[model samples]
Target chain A: MMIISTSYHIFVKEFVSEFRTRYALNALLMFVVTTLSIILFSIGQESPSIDVLSGTLWIVIFFSAMSGLSRTFVAEEERGTSLTLRLLVNASSVYIGKLVYNFALILVLSVIIAVSYVLFITEFTVKTFEIFWLTILLGSAGLASASTILAAIIAKANTKGTLFPVLAFPILLPLLLTCINATKLATEGAFLVEAVKEFQILISFTVVMIATSFLVFDFVWKD
Target chain B: MKTWLKIAVSVWLTGIIIAGIAFPMVKVPQTWYEFPFIPGLEEKARNIIFHVPISWATVVAFAMSMIYGIIYLRKKDIDYDLRSVSSASLGLLLCILATVTGAIWAKFNWGSFWNWDPRQTSIFILLLIYGAYFVLRSAIDEEERRATLSSVYSIIAGVTVPFFIFVMPRIMSGLHPGSLGDEQGKGPVLEFKMAPNMLMVFFASLIGFTVLYFWMYSLKVRQMRIERHVQQITETH
Candidate 1:
């Protein structure tokens, strides 16, 4: 219970700070829009297949994550608030706070991505909304958890920009693969029942990621 | 290395090399040649001597690296960190060797240097995972911090190696051969199709590769330890 309130307070702190600067949010929107427009312009008047669209959607989400979520811990580092925060609260609290914040950011980003895809891509259609949305939710959670931990990691490194994605690609491979497959099924109007395996994979990936990151966060955060 | 251990390794390596080249030429009954093989793999199947053992040795080295990484995290000893990197670099070298040998075998057997098979895909991902480990190492500056962070990264990366190597390959269909469909052993050996002579050479190669991997690992660890000691002594002066 104390952990929850501490985490919530930290989340609120970050949220208020983000609202004041709007740095991450501004960067995220600009990136999403620019990349989305570029993709739309490149495919002008051509109907890409569902597989291409699915792959493109994930690529967009992944890179957008690379651009935005990397800032989660970088902000603390830049503000010199990391040490102060470290002294103030438990490591798990800070991790949970950051994790939740990133999760919300990713959820919003996914919705924007989904909306942009429908408006820009000519042939994009969601036959199985339930499956698609479920994938978005689960995939976003997995991506947020993964990137948050990794962002914490690279935040302390020198060449952070390059290191973040390089470290992320392999870890995110399993999740990305599962998401693409599920999205394909959704695009093809497959039953929600058919995506059960993908759901299980996403769920397990999220659980394992959060559990392991929590176990190790103390070491990473404190040290 | 101890004289006896050095002598043993050299002798073991020489015996395996000689056996690998010579034993395959031993007059096996015609039935041995009659066994099913891929189109151009008849002679190329001999690559199993190098390819299979090198692949196994690479996995062994990776497991060694992860174990050492775990120990480093727990013990905070820079020596374990050195051991971890030593084994990792050796493992990556073995992994590259496995890929090259595999590509050569594929060129002869599958008729293409790159087939994008599931096995190939899995190996490629394993390479990336290990490659990322070094990238993470280089991005950090401090000695102890680099050791700590890289060890944590190593354990995380290690979790994916098994998934990529074993589970992903099984889930995706491929032309790499040996379906291993609920057979007795792991991989092609499970098919139990090899001749007794082939099995003997295979075992010999496996032992030789394992011995070679450990030899490289120990040599690297010693070199790094000496370098660290030299650095500390010179800095103190």
Candidate 2:
């Protein structure tokens, strides 16, 4: 109970500071717009298949995540606040807080991408809103859970920018596969029951990732 | 380190080498209609003798790496860290060997050097995950910090091994042979489709490769410990 409030306070603190600085926000939005525009221009005037659109959507989310989520711990280390954080809060609290921040940040990014996909790609459509939304939301959480500890790990390294995505790609591959498949199903008008298998896989992947992160984040966070 | 165990491992390796080659050739006539294997793989299935063992060795190496990584974190001993990285490095080597051998086999059977088969994709992802571990190791300069961070990263990466190697492939259709509905139309893998002699060779290969993995792992761990000692002496001077 006490841990929950402490983590919530950390999240609130992160949210306030983020709105003030807006570095991650700016980075995420710029990445999304630039990548989406390039994709829009390069593939101009061709009606991409639902599969292609689904794949492209995930590519955009993945790269945007690379841009924004890597900053979660790098910001602390750069500001020299990591020591202060270590002193002030428990490792789990810090991890939960950053994880919540990342989850919210990516959720917003995913929503923006979904909306932008709808607007930019005229033929792009989701036949099942629940599956589409569910994939995006759960996928965002899974991505956050996987990347948060990695961000902490990379934050201490020298070539952080290159390290984050290289490390993240393999760990996130299964999640990405399921999410892309689920998205494909939704776009192809599959019902929730029809796509339930993917949903279950994604849920399990998220659960495993989150649980593993919690188990080990203390070591990564403290070190 | 026991002398008899060492002798046993060496003899096992020798036996595997001879049997892996000779048994496949002599166990049954290569041209017999009585033989049971995927028809095309009848001869080239010999690759399975080396290929399956190496892949299984890779998995064993990885599991050991993760186990040692957990120990290093708990004990915070540098030797544990050394064991962890050495096992991972060996795992990466064995993984590459499996990929190459599997690819060579694929070229003969699948008619292409590189098909985007489910099994192939999973192994490729495994390559990336372990590849990133080495990258992570080299990117850090402080010895203790590097050990701690890499251990944590390896643990995180280890969680995905089952997904990439097993669960993900099972969910998708692919060219790789599996228990049911394998792309090659080979039914369940463990059924009577396996000849008695083939089963014996398979068990021998599994045991032989496991012993071989442990031999390589211990050798690397000892080498790393000596290097660390040398560094410490130099620092004292």
Candidate 3:
């Protein structure tokens, strides 16, 4: 109860700070817009298949994550509030709080990207909205859970910006692959039950990532 | 390592190599020395003795690195950090060797150097994971922080290994032997049986390469220890 309450407090703090300056949100939105337009312009008048569009949508979300999500911890470090947070909050609470924040952030980013992707890409149509939404939800959860701990890890590194994606891509490969497949199936009008395997893998992946991050975040957080 | 162990490893690996290369692949095996001809694999099946073992060693090395990382986190001993890094570097080397050898074998068998097979994709991901591990290690300037952070990163990476190397590959259909729908597939490589003599050499190669990995890991740790000691001595003076 105590941990939950503390983490909730921290989560609220994170949102308040994020909304005040809109730094991460603005950067993330711009990244998504820029990449989507660039992709749209380059493939002008050629209708790429659903496969390519699905891949491209995830790629946009992923790079936008790489660009913007690190701010959760990196901002705290930059503002010199990490010490205060360390002294005031336990490591697990800080982790959970930041994880929730990242989850919400990534969820919003993915939805925006998904909406724009469907609107902009003529060939990309989702016959099954159920699987498509489920994929987005689970993929964002997995991405956010995986990247939160990684953000903490990279916060201590010298090359903060480049290290996040370098450290993130390989670890996130399994998740990305499953998300792409599920999205592909969703676009092809597959039934909800048709993506059972992908759903299982995605759920397990997110659970394992979150559990391991919880176990190891202490080591990464403390001196 | 002891002198006798080193001698045994050297001799054992040499014998395996000789047997692996010199052993004849014949259609019928009347004697213990001759291996049964595995259709499609033919002469290329010899790679199982050499290539498969190296990949096995790679797994062992990465597992060891993860183990040592866990130990370091628990004990806060820099020595364990050294051990972890040493094993990881060795794992990376063995992984590269396995990939290159597999590629060469694939060129003759699959008609392409890179098939993007499930196994190939998994190994490629493993390489990226560890490569990122090293990059993470190098980006930290402080000793204890670097050790702790990298250990945590390695543990996270290690947890995902089974998913990448084993689960994902088998779940997806591909050219790999154990892949889904491979049982009834056209490739005889799926049903290829290993003769008893060939199996013996394969196990022997696995054991030998694993021993060699430990030897290399110990040497690396010792070198790093000496370097750390020398730096401390110089700094004090």
Candidate 4:
């Protein structure tokens, strides 16, 4: 109960600080826009298939995450506020707080990207709103859960900027594959029942990632 | 490692290699030594004795690395960190060997060096995971911080190995044997086929390579320990 309250406070702190600067938000949004434009320009007037568009949508989300999500811990370390954070809350609370914050950030970013992707990319149409939305939700959860601990790990390293995606890509590949497939199914007018395997895998992946992050965050946090 | 174990591994691996290569595929097994000729696999099947064991050893090595990572986090012992890194490096080496050998086998069987098979894709991702692990270790100059962070990363990566190597491949339809909808009945290459003699050699090769990994792991840990001691002494001076 105490842990929950402490983590909630930390989450509030992250939310306030984030909105005040809007640093990660701007970075994430700009990244999505820029990548979408580049993709748009390269394709010229040709409309790619839904398969390519679904895969492209997740690619944008994945790279946008790679660009922005590491800021959660890296910023704390950069400002030397990590020491103050350590003094304030326990390690697990800090982890949970950062995880929630990152999840919320990624969720917002993904929804915006999805909206823009649908608006700009006329070729991309969602036949099944249910599957598309569920994929985004689970993908965000999985991304946040996996990246939060990795953000902590890389924050303590020498080269913070380049290390986040390197460490994240392989760990997140399974999730990406499932998300892309589910998104494809969504675009193809598949029913919810058709994507049951993808959903199960997504749920299990998020659960395992979050549970393991909690288990090991102590070692990464205190040190 | 014990001297007898070392000697045994050397002899065992060599014997398995010789048998795996020299053992002839025949229509029917006249004796215990003859291997039954599998219809599709034929001669290329011998690659399993060498290739499959390396991949198995890779999995074992990653599991050991994760185990030691957990121990290091609990005990704060640098030795366990050393053990963890050493095992991971060996795992990386074995993983590459598996990929290369699998590619060679694929060239003959699948008509290309790269099939994007589920098994191939999983191994490639695994390689990326551990490759990033080493990059993470190198980026941290402080000894304890490096150890702790890398250990944590290893644990995270290790937990996903099952999802990648085992679960993903089985769920996705692919060229690999035992994949979803595989007409081979989804039991993997080991279960549905293999004559008795071939199975014996395969199991022997598996045990041999596993023991070989432990031997290599111990040697690596000792080497790293000596290097650490040397660095500490020089720093003090």
Candidate 4's residue-wise lDDT over A130-210, tens digit each?
999999999999999999999988888999999999999999988998899899889999999999988898899999999
- How do the residues A1-223 of candidate 3 rate in per-residue lDDT, one tens digit apiece? 9999999999999999988999888978888889999999988999887888889889998999888787778888899999999999999999999999899999999999999888987888999999999999999999999999999999998999889999999999888988999998999899999998888888999999999999999988886
Q: What lDDT is reached at residue B143 by model 4? A: 92
Which segments of model 3 are wrong by more than 4 Å? B165-171, B181-192
| Model 4 C-alpha lDDT per residue in residues B1-237, reported as the tens digit of each score | 999999989999999989999988888889887888776778988988999999999989988898998899999999999999999999999999999999999999889999688889888988998999999999999998988998899889878877775446534568765555466636777785887788999999999999999999999999999999999999999
Query: Over the stretch B118-206, how does candidate 2's per-residue lDDT look in tens digits?
Result: 77887898899889999999999999899999888888888876765445654566666553446454554445245666677777888
CAPRI tier for the interface of model 2: medium
Going through the candidates in the order shown, the clash numbers are 0, 0, 0, 0
| lDDT of each residue in B180-215, candidate 3, tens digit only | 545433454424578878988988999999999889
Candidate 2 accuracy as TM-score: 0.94
Individual DockQ of the candidates?
0.57, 0.71, 0.71, 0.72
Comparing 2 with 3 on lDDT, the higher-scoring candidate is: 3
Where in model 2 is the C-alpha error above 4 Å?
B23-38, B165-171, B183-192
Docking model 3 quality class: medium
Strongest candidate by DockQ: 4
Question: What value does the lDDT take at residue A178 in candidate 3?
Answer: 87
Model 2, A214: alpha-carbon shift in Å?
1.1
Candidate 1 Cα misplacement greater than 4 A, ranges: B24-40, B165-171, B180-189
lDDT digits (tens) for residues A26-120 of candidate 1: 88999999999999898888887888899999999999988888888887898899999988899999999999999999999988998888777
TM-score ranking, best first: 3, 4, 2, 1
The candidate 4 chain A region of ten consecutive residues with least summed lDDT is A22-31
TM values, all candidates: 0.93, 0.94, 0.96, 0.96
